[model samples]
Target: MSSSPQPEAELAKLRFTLEAANAAMWDIDLVANTVVWSENAEQVLGLRPGALSTTFVAEPEWIHPEDRAGTLTALWEAARGGETYVIEHRIVTADGETRWVTARGGAVLDDDGSPARVVGVLVDITDRQLLAERLRGELAAKDRFLTTIGHELRTPLTAILGFSAELHDRLSDEELAPVRDIAQIITQQADQMVALIDDLLVAGRDADSPVPIDPHQVELCGTVRRVIDGWPDEHRGSVSIDEGPVRAFADPIRLRQIVRNLIDNAIRYGGPTITVRCWETPIEGRSHLVVIDDGPGIPSTPPEPDTGVHPTGIGLAVSRRLAERMGGSLSYEHVDGTTRFELELPLEA
Candidate 1:
């Protein structure tokens, strides 16, 4: 038979184990008005274990000023009630570094059910707390970016649309044609800019607003035809939309913008013939809308611009942003000397 451990031997063993563990251990004797802490406590709190001899009460001064009173009050209540106490708080080390820690304890009761002692464990949670704070900051930044872009784009777009409409209404037949062309170009460019701004906003907001989209049921073919019809015949080049209408549940306006931007970019950078195809395929229980184009093809790397804007690259970026917002993705592939742009939006059932 194994012999039972004496009280002193058992306590000594516990002290040894606590000293070896990473966590800090503390014990307070209520009646004796004294306190003892393991060596690890000094490392955790930046205080020598034996430096404070009067009482453990002053040790709470190391806690963050904002949390010290509340923590002490809670612990006192738990001790008075002969119950367990658990709390997490911030403390300042001797070097003045703030660290997060979780402390848990239970009251040790006398034979008469009166509280005589309190024992507790303290663990550093600084790393986990910092990570959580960083994530919150990132989310707030994204929200701010979306709101700012929306406000900025609306101002310029309103002016362009209003002036173009007024010019179209005021010009005479002889004077109208040239003025009309100018107004139309202004309107088209303004619309494109607004669409790009919206896409950027969408990308920033997507995490919070993921909506189910159905690409198979959306009238994609008609949307493409309409966009092409809006372009002048000279700049229109060879445009083709497959015979069948493909349906998708993506925001109709955003989808149209994606198609228009791609086709516009192809005409601006590629040869006259621009082919647009829309189709749906199921992938892992979701549907996708794919738009391909045969353009001069995106450069292996983005070009270094010396002066003017590179509309093709800008348009592709906008399209990708929109696709991501609609719970989808956009990608490019070059095959057989043709550059293909694919926009994939999740299908809404």
Candidate 2:
């Protein structure tokens, strides 16, 4: 075997490794109140070589004012025989620019089992931190835009809905049948627009939180029937339901949204015929509604990497979220060349 490496060679190797990783080594002597830094410490910190401070106490001046106290406290604790610590804080450069850095350190003990020095490595993370901040800003801006547009659209939509309803109620006589039909159509379309805007408003809010809902006793079959009836005449002919008397404690509006979205997905992506079935499982004391279609199943693989595009569209996602918020769950499966979406809910006693 080759001779063991000399101390100088080992130090050179360590310096080379640190340089490759864009990090600098630092050591603070507790008893002497002094600090030492590797040759590249100033360079890593965006300062000219030999310009870095050597005094242990003066190091906090380089740290951002908001983070100086916490950083100093953590280092002091580590030097006082505390456990190893890792901290990410902002550092201020000589030119008043702020940069993020991650520091990791531990105490080095003397023979008496007391910390004699605190040693650590510092790595620059300014680029990564800035990128994360920019992304967050973009998301906030997008949410604000969506919320504003949704509210603006809703104002006109509400007026349309109110006028259409008033006109429908006023023209109930048989002689003005054609006008009443047009008014009814306008009312239905405006109501659909309201639901769409509501979805947009919800999307503009924080997604991690569950969708808000108000739940009450609901005649489940009637809700499902209303969603089916709302479909256009042409597509409505292709849909059928096995309507059983089922009661559920749920948000009727959101329940209708879920049902309508499922049916719409089926009509768009599924086969020509669609079937909906609702029933209560006595043993489980829960109610379930299943929408089945004979169309091709969801694609086995996504079309593009990292693109979370659902095969059917965003409606399924919204419907599933609403179902879960109302103490129910929506799930999908493909069996025997048939695609089935099932919604399970708590049964109203």
Candidate 3:
């Protein structure tokens, strides 16, 4: 058999290899209260190796003031339990730059099985911490942007609707004909703006919690009729609704907004006649509210604002957003030269 190596010589080799590694290494003698740290510790803790007589002296002193208490508490708990210490916290470097670090360590036992020393390793995690913070900031900015757009759009829309109503009330029959047409156009555009604002608000809210609305128990048919009645008789396209009272549990106002947007978009971009069909079907233990429109279909390519000319408006985008907020979906396809827009909402129980 080969001769066994001396224990002291073998330990020295292991220590040398650990010191050469990049990670910060440390040891604390519990009885003597003395501490030893590798040269790499300076890079992690901003302190020279062996700078302080005791590890506790070097702690709180170099650690970020805000993190000192929590870090000490965790470290002390691990030490008392005779277990490894593992923690991540912010630290101030030698040059006064803040960074994040992860530390892992364990207790060393004496011959009597009592805790004698604690040793550990540390790794820098500053880059990963910064990246997480950046993502959170970006999400907050998006929410603020949506809220601002809704507020701004609502102001102009309210003014347009109020003024149009006033004009409709004051004009004489002969004078009212032309004024009524102008008022109708204003009202239509105002309604479109309102729908857009509602979509933004609902999308922001739904980002937090989503709940399904019942479409079979709500008054959807009445809401559709009211929207059609608001349109001007001359300029309004011929609208037909199949007979029957359709009920859905969705927000009545939001449902009306979706239908109004689809119908308005059809008239603006497609033909003069707009047909709305409401029907319910059971699929996999759930009822669905289907609204189909025969209009110019959505282009396979995504809609662009400055496309010069197209048979689609932003209303489709708003409708899709509203449908999703109510836990439904909107889809479009073309069949036999007719562009069809479909809104599917969950039917009431």
The CA lDDT of each predicted structure is 0.72, 0.81, 0.69
By lDDT, the candidates rank as 2, 1, 3
Assess every candidate by TM-score: 0.56, 0.63, 0.57
Q: What is the lDDT of residue 341 in candidate 2?
A: 96
The candidate that achieves the highest TM-score relative to the unseen native structure = 2
Off by over 4 Å in 2: 1-21, 29-34, 46-55, 76-83, 107-117, 175-179, 200-307, 321-349
Model 3 over residues 196-268: C-alpha lDDT tens digits? 6775565454443332344435766567778888677753447666668755557777787787777766665
Candidate 1 lDDT score relative to the true structure: 0.72
lDDT at 214 for candidate 1?
Answer: 38
Report the C-alpha lDDT of model 1 over 1-349, residue by residue, as the tens digit.
Answer: 9999999898788767765655688889999888887656777676655544447675466789999988888788889998888899998887788999888988999999999998888888888899978887887787787778789878979898789867866775885689887887887788767767765565455444432343444676778888777566776657766778666667777787788777776776566666777766645434444444556576655444652224345566667766776777888777886777777665554
Q: What pairs collide in candidate 2?
A: none
Backbone clashes in candidate 1 total 12
What digit string (tens of lDDT, one per residue) describes model 2 on residues 233-300?
77788988785578788988889888877887888779999988888886887889889999986766
* Ranking of candidates on TM-score, top first: 2, 3, 1
Model 3 bad stretches (over 4 Å): 1-125, 138-142, 145-149, 199-217, 234-237, 282-296, 303-311
Q: In angstroms, give how far residue 85 of model 2 lies from its true place.
A: 3.1
